[model samples]
Target: MSKPYFDPDFDNLLERINGPTCRVCIDNESMEDCTVVKVDSVNKQGLLLEVVQVLTELNLTISKSYISSDAGWFMDVFHVKDEHGNKLTDQKLINYIQQGIGTTRETPSSAKAKTYTNKVFRPERNGYTTIEMSGTDRPGLFSEISAALAYLHCNIVEAHAWSHNDRLACVAYITDQSADTPIDDPGRLADIEEHLTMVLRATTAPSTSGNQANQQEVKTAGFLQGSEDQGTMTNVERRLHQLMLSVRDFDGPSGPPNLPAVTPTGSEESDEEGRRTVVMIESCDEKGYSIVSIDCRDRPRLMFDTVCTLTDMQYVIFHASISSGGGYAFQEYFIRHLDGRALSTESEKERVIKCLEAAIERRVCEGVRVELCADNRAGLLSDITRVLRENGLTVVRADVATQGEKAVNALYVKDISGNEVDMEFVESMKREMGPIVLHVRNETNGRSSLPPRSSRFSLGDMLKSQIDRFNSLTAL
Candidate 1:
């Protein structure tokens, strides 16, 4: 965990700023057969998603919601109920919900910290490098893993992760971003392994030792402080920063607001009619990968959805540049098959384009919706869809996106028996899917109960077993 670049005073300012706070007050009167949960908190990125996750795990159906954010504060009111279409009376459950969404304040540290183990190992693989880790689960675990990968310059192509009973396992297929190949240098691979091991160990380790606890607290405080700073930035400033990072010539017509001469990178593609998105793939022999360029009208989670689809389909992204301007996003990804071959046939290219297009379109549709955010693991999409299918939920549309270690999935569905999604069905689905999402979220957030001995296994084999167990547990 390298300290984020920031002014010396920034940490002090963050310490003074209040983080998010949550309160769950059960509505006793007014709304019949419903409980209203009101949340007032300082706004941060992904706040809504986190709230939804907590409610879903509690088996509460949100029949209606009023959400608003102003300046830096957010107030959300959710009309919720149990499966029997009755108001909730469980004080225990209400307490659990409050605890789940409660904010933890960060205190800045006076001393610098060492963050890595610096040990690395090279696993034997031909085209891809496999990194697998298992440990006691904790909050912010996935974010730490993602940071480690980014620090090592490793590009994740595919991933499968799961957490069960306070234990977590993650497997990722990666390639060196600069070289577009499996990490071959023993020294570099050693460093990658060492750093990630340290991150996982630190998160999993108990804080009984006062010295270690202090160190961990300081590290987390710094990380949260950086998050606070980013959350305070205006949308325009954030977008402008993204634009500057993606475009080489800031003077072009496509530059940020008021820079009329800076030309936008995807303006030509935007000129076309009717198509909200354009996907182009071309072979790059020298690089041994295909170049994928996507120009589209930007919307929420566009990049995450695109990357999720690619990873799910087993395509490997070596290098990528993602930028948004005005109202559109321009993206370029250097990709290859898992077997290290370029996409060759027209059919293959069309399939790739169609998948990306469909994923983008799904994000804009509405139906009987369920939202999930968790640590991204390999075969996670399969497991989620399997649960829905088993519960007779017919999926009409689906959207999956990942930011850092968190995968957010939205599914639009209907009952297979041609009935509207009633309370019974919603409860059933929640009961089945709640633990899966909660476990991943908890593990990624660096919170866990205890590690199970059976949790240790290879990534592929472990995924299969875990899915099988879930099926057995949720089998109708």
Candidate 2:
């Protein structure tokens, strides 16, 4: 869609800079003075402004921010002393900030590193063509390779990442936020791909050597969005980013197909036209769990594409959550509302599941795994902690898991010695804690709720407990 442009001057630094101190930093390092209050997707300058604008919008305060630019490579440094500066714990957020600017989630992923994947559209950005890059994960690889994108002003918007027990993959989406500049400049993408080749090179020994092991593939795809869809695009883009991260986080491609809720009764949607119908999945999170995994594979983009395909095929979406593999994914979509279209023919359901199954197959690793069971018992959490302590680990964040009359305690922790933990230890601890199951991990990346750093307890649970105590005192 063609978007009109306006060049607005960013003379209001005071408002953005009005936070508490002049010196702001992250991980204790001080940032140089850098404050921008506006963004222009048309001109390259506006891209910088958008970076600043997104940080500000997320309520992230960084004082004395410093930026380095050489050729087309760019590096931005800032400090965030608190969570509000970065609410959601997202790998994408970290990657976004590392490159330039991005949004923050209300829920934070408490980790030294976070990685996610997403899909985005820039209707008609000017000056800078939006560019993104992603591939297998490597240490310090991003810093060395992103210089190419920075040199060409490929402001990073989002990055998605995930690795199996042995392999890794990543994707980064960047849009030129410069006003008065085109959003699809060839120089931008070319610079990015060149640097991408450099960034993706393996300096270390190969792990997946044979046919699947010795090589790596990095491909790029792009599409311009429509103007009428801009309003929806923001939601779509943000969700896409979240979905990408969720997939990588969950390692969706490694999991099995989620059980289909609709059983085939040998009934065909009476439509002789043979149009495909969408899979209609409706169920509370899996039994014994509040959240389950979805095979996101291509991240939420796969989910989005599937949803779009269903819509085009005349299906309707009632509710959806692309974050989980919901490949173990969940959606209450069907063709019930189609214009007299018989939606759930036996073949249609089979075909829809097949389509999603294919999506999971191509994207999911044949290796990811997940397991769940009830966890509500006395001293369950304490036992979990005891086991962790015995295993030479420390609890980083533990949650109070209760269902009805039972209580189950869950924790997110890391090995203090950085030792590779045995699955048996985790399972044994769960058994001791009476969590109802031994272990649960996404089949692909082995990404589980236990490993990642989490801060979910910061939300109202404590306050609610305190309120409960006060009410009990009143009753006494």
Candidate 3:
């Protein structure tokens, strides 16, 4: 028996390694793209084990590799292709790789360089973005649209909504929620628009299904509202909207727009850049109501930076915006890009607003009650962390408060041992900080489900079956 092999930085293990020579070809090409890479190690088995991933990804025939006729010089040669136009052969493979890598310019076929360049932006300094929604009204228009947006997760910065003549038009700065969600896919946006239309129709004017109550909920749904009470969407509009959203190619058939080819400052592309989007934002609103005020040059940059950060951190973009002011305090004008994908779920969407509103409260008035009071000496973040650590709890995320000499910290903590530090620990940390405050908790962290789980098979049965198979095979 051979000693097992091991790769320090990767998953390859030496003990179970097999040689590169395969007498039979194993090909399964239903889904994953076929790409393969072969390796040469201390032995043929070790090298073959290392190349498993390359084999799966490249989808190559392993039996046809360049294997040494003599056992002394062990080598596994894969037929992988490189930009240098050389096949992975026994002799020139290493030299071919040297030419393939460490170059200043990348090749067109380099999947590593494929990019999805998206951006999530708040309102910008001088640019403008506008969203005009015109449709028949229905009950739950506002709530459904707002709720759908709440579901899709978006924020309204500067909005002017009204029912004019007989139609509804809604416009606002959508970049308020975080630039992680983009309204780029015409299909998705259209679906959302259709849903918005349905939501609006349902809210503005119910289809005789609603008398008045659900209809009222529709009116305040979002900005898009028609005075009529309607719900549910007609087939034609829904189909058309869905068709429009089927856009996948980021760069259109005409190629990138003829703007000066300059990368935006502070924008980061992925290692594999698969797609990219550009947006311009502009708007105005009540300064005190949100941090969304246009103070100077950096203000727009901050908004831009926030969007960029969202896109870079997640895959989303702020497509466009346009705005002017209304609210209160320091008058403002701004527009923002609403990146839809940023908030992964409807609940997350609510949290997005929750955070934004908190930011807005602080912006409107510095000393406004943002959250619960903090404990000082015991309440300090470090002390609380110490308590959590001492109790085998790992702090997931934390928010702290400070006023004059006193402080308070709220922590979201969990333990690797599957046991959580209780309210006692939280109170203890609070006491260590300064004044002891009551601890409120959500006990949902890491507690295993007590409810019966549904699975295809039980572990005990699975183990027995495996043992039976092994016994039968050994006897054979």
Question: Which candidate number maximizes lDDT?
Answer: 1
Q: Is candidate 1 or candidate 2 better by TM-score?
A: 2
Model 2 has an lDDT value of 0.35
Query: Can you write out model 2's per-residue Cα lDDT over 1-476, one digit (the tens) per residue?
Result: 98877543234345324522122223322223322222111112123223443454344543223343223322344333223333334556544553343222111211112222322224453222333333443333333333444455544343333332222334444545344234444554455556566656554543454543323444343333323222233323332332333233223222222211222222222122331223333333332111112332223234433433343334433222332221233333322333333433455554555444333333333221322234232222333344344445543222233345443333333444434334444444333423245454423244333442242222123323433554577589
Q: Cα RMSD (Å) per model?
A: 22.2, 22.6, 27.2
Find the 10 residues in a row with the least total lDDT in model 1: 216-225
The TM-score obtained by model 3 is 0.19
Order the candidate numbers by TM-score, best to worst: 2, 1, 3
Q: Which lDDT tens digits does candidate 1 get at residues 94-130?
A: 7776775664212232012212232222334236565
What lDDT tens digits, residue by residue, belong to model 3 across residues 29-105? 22143223333333321222223222322322222234331233233343333333334443344443333221201
lDDT of each: 0.50, 0.35, 0.29
Predicted structure 1, TM vs. truth? 0.27
- What does the lDDT read for residue 201 in candidate 2? 56
